[model samples]
Target: MNALPNIVDSETGQGLPRYDLRVENHGPSDLEFEIWQIPYNGTPDVKKPLRISGLRGRNLALIEHRVLRLLAKAGIHLGGLNIQDQARYALNEDQALNLGLLFRTLAPMRNRENMPMVADGIEAMGKEEAAYWLGMAMHRKYPRRVLMALRFLLIDPKARMKD
Candidate 1:
């Protein structure tokens, strides 16, 4: 059997059994903060939905590998599904809708490499097409921060910096 990866806690460096991330308000204000755990690889049969309180009372999907990585960095572990398993079962339509709303509100930052993918999916495409591809990527990654960055790109094509 393939051994699971040992994702260390960003702050503590302790090994984690599973990984999960939660969004909370940093202070009394509405600003959102991401709390995460270490990464692990396991079966998807035990995966569960992630609840983020600061996201306007919506539960965010947590089935993407990247999302797992982000969570691991913060010290979270999914109970059942590992990174690979999450990649297999991406988000559904309703999840995508919720993610879109979160993305619009969060407007987080992302890596530069992913910008092109977002651009290719949006430029010259109709609104429906743009939404579809963006939705697909969002479902696959479930990285709310990255999705928010992509949402910004979608809203303003020319605003994104060139790769």
Candidate 2:
């Protein structure tokens, strides 16, 4: 099979990806399956969407893996502090809102590369929100490692950067 020629722009020296297009005249059968690189204005950003579309699943996994590691490390470190009873405290509505907001703000920055930002997000929360997160750690529904991490974050947010 013949490869499509590289289509490029004359002015900006930009290039477009090649495509294999086949067209045939069924009645006369004069034309057969073929492809080409035509010089025309095409969607330059078309490949951009294609590149990003396949990244969602992989990116989610990356984020989740990073979060798990981060939380696990936090939990281990906090265990050193030796707060066995792990008392819970009442949370303010505003603090809850702030905690949600913090997650909202960090969701986009998820990934191993953006680990530093995670700590920054935690620190951005007011003391009230941090305290609320500490309470969340006491709940059985939350993963033990992540729960410990949250508790440690409330106590020492700086540990986030260490990851």
Candidate 3:
């Protein structure tokens, strides 16, 4: 078994779904990412952690664009958020931290280049949504693996069943 590089551990006590992300570079063009979701209430099972893998960088970007377009079409007034030159929308300290961690985990190679502009688009995406898009992107090539990821995301046992 091979180990991944830059495996970021999740922060506890945030009451948010913890994200454990691992990014491994197989080559100049090939990369693999594994995201483990640690529910706030329980310990993550290491051996059976729900994994979303094989999402190409291009695909992830595509999903990001689609999401932005959809939001725009919905009349959300995202003008300030779409500013290309600078960060017109201020992210408080915590969102800034989340953005940095997510950007590094998702696109480590491009982390230093035009980060503020790129963050303009994805800064609104919560961690779980980012993970979901990543899983959907992987589903483009590997369908079966994404099923487990879907089940994990869609079914929250703690939520009470509606009548």
Q: Which has the greatest lDDT?
A: 3
Tens digits of per-residue lDDT for model 1, 1-163: 3433454457876643343323433333222323222223332433454332123211222223333443455445554443323211223223333333334433332434443344334334554554565445545656565456555555544444552
RMSD of 3: 15.2
C-alpha local distance difference test of each model: 0.39, 0.38, 0.40
Model 3: which residue pairs collide?
A: none
Report the C-alpha lDDT of model 2 over 1-163, residue by residue, as the tens digit. Answer: 4433555667977653433222223222122222222232464534331210011233334443443344354341212222222212222223333333333333344345554455455646676665466446434485455544653444444544687
Please list the Cα RMSD from the true structure of every candidate, rounded to 1 decimal place: 15.8, 24.9, 15.2
- On TM-score, the candidate that comes out on top is 3
Could you give me the TM-score of model 2 versus the true structure? 0.22
Per-candidate clash tally: 16, 0, 0
Clashes by residue pair, model 2: none
Ranking by TM-score: 3, 1, 2
> What lDDT score goes with residue 139 in model 1?
54
Q: What is the alpha-carbon lDDT for the whole of candidate 2?
A: 0.38
- Which residues of candidate 1, in runs, are more than 4 Å off? 1-26, 30-46, 51-101, 104-106, 110-135, 139-153, 156-163
What TM-score does candidate 3 reach?
Answer: 0.28
